[model samples]
Target: MKKRNKFKHFLYLILALAMLVYALPLISFKEGWSWASAFGVAWSLFAFLVIGAHLHYLLGVDEEKQKTLERIRAAKLREWQLKWPEDTQRRQENM
Candidate 1:
């Protein structure tokens, strides 16, 4: 399989593991497991997810944050211009 496919499989595996953690606590609680052990298992699962997230970011397998910020800024500027047409015209003329 290709590298990207492998990565996707890895992510899916992680997702499955995360889902398992969500279900495990409920099962453990029902099975009369001790609170301390349950908490430990949950905490370890959370740490696993945290590490997985960091690894994902390190690999840059996501959209660029700057692009999202730029889109937000552009939308805000458009909203401001719509609310204050005269201010926008004045700023444009000043340039």
Candidate 2:
């Protein structure tokens, strides 16, 4: 798991660098910013924020493991509690 997480992080770093290289060139630093230059910079920043957020979320999460844990919890709850129909029946009887 540690190795996999490291690999995933490395991949995200590479992607971020690639995106930066691709989009940074679109911006012009010359005096009197044109509309196109402003738009390019905004678009690049937006892309970075979105991709960074996704990578941040992905780094800490393991979907398969989370699902398995959830299933185990559900199974334990079923073992400890009355089934739905039985509980409903008991409730009706009490009323």
Candidate 3:
């Protein structure tokens, strides 16, 4: 229902698909696929997993940053409210 939850679900789906794509080549290679082709596929899968791990780490960092920002923003807003109760009342009056 919430946008943030939707985004989390979408991110999970993307990661799953990426992992599946990276694994497909290995399964095919085990089924008597060409040596050269299998090597290339395996290498690509290795690279994909490495890159995916890096991206996943970066996403975690970004999520932390977002939470920190939200907390800072909320604190600032609360401070503002406490400092200017009259202003808040004035704004409500104008509305």
What C-alpha lDDT values do all the predictions have? 0.71, 0.78, 0.71
What digit string (tens of lDDT, one per residue) describes model 1 on residues 48-91?
77657756764657657767889999999899878898888889
Compared with the true structure, model 3 gives a TM-score of 0.34
Tens-digit lDDT string for candidate 3 (1-95): 55676576557657756776766655554546788767767766675666666566545766788899999999999999897988888899999
Model 3 C-alpha lDDT versus the unseen true structure: 0.71
Position 8, candidate 1: lDDT: 71
Top-lDDT structure, candidate number: 2
Candidate 2 vs candidate 3: which has greater lDDT?
2
The clash numbers for all candidates, in the given order, read 0, 0, 0
Q: Of the pair 1 and 2, which is ahead by lDDT?
A: 2
Clashing pairs in 3: none
Per-residue lDDT tens digits for candidate 2, residues 1-95, read 96787677667767877888887876787866889888888888777886776576666566777899999999999876757778789899999
Error of 2 at 41 (Å): 1.5
Scored by Cα lDDT, where does model 1 land?
Answer: 0.71
What TM-score goes with each of the models?
Answer: 0.34, 0.49, 0.34
Which portions of model 3 miss their true places by more than 4 Å?
1-54, 57-59, 88-95
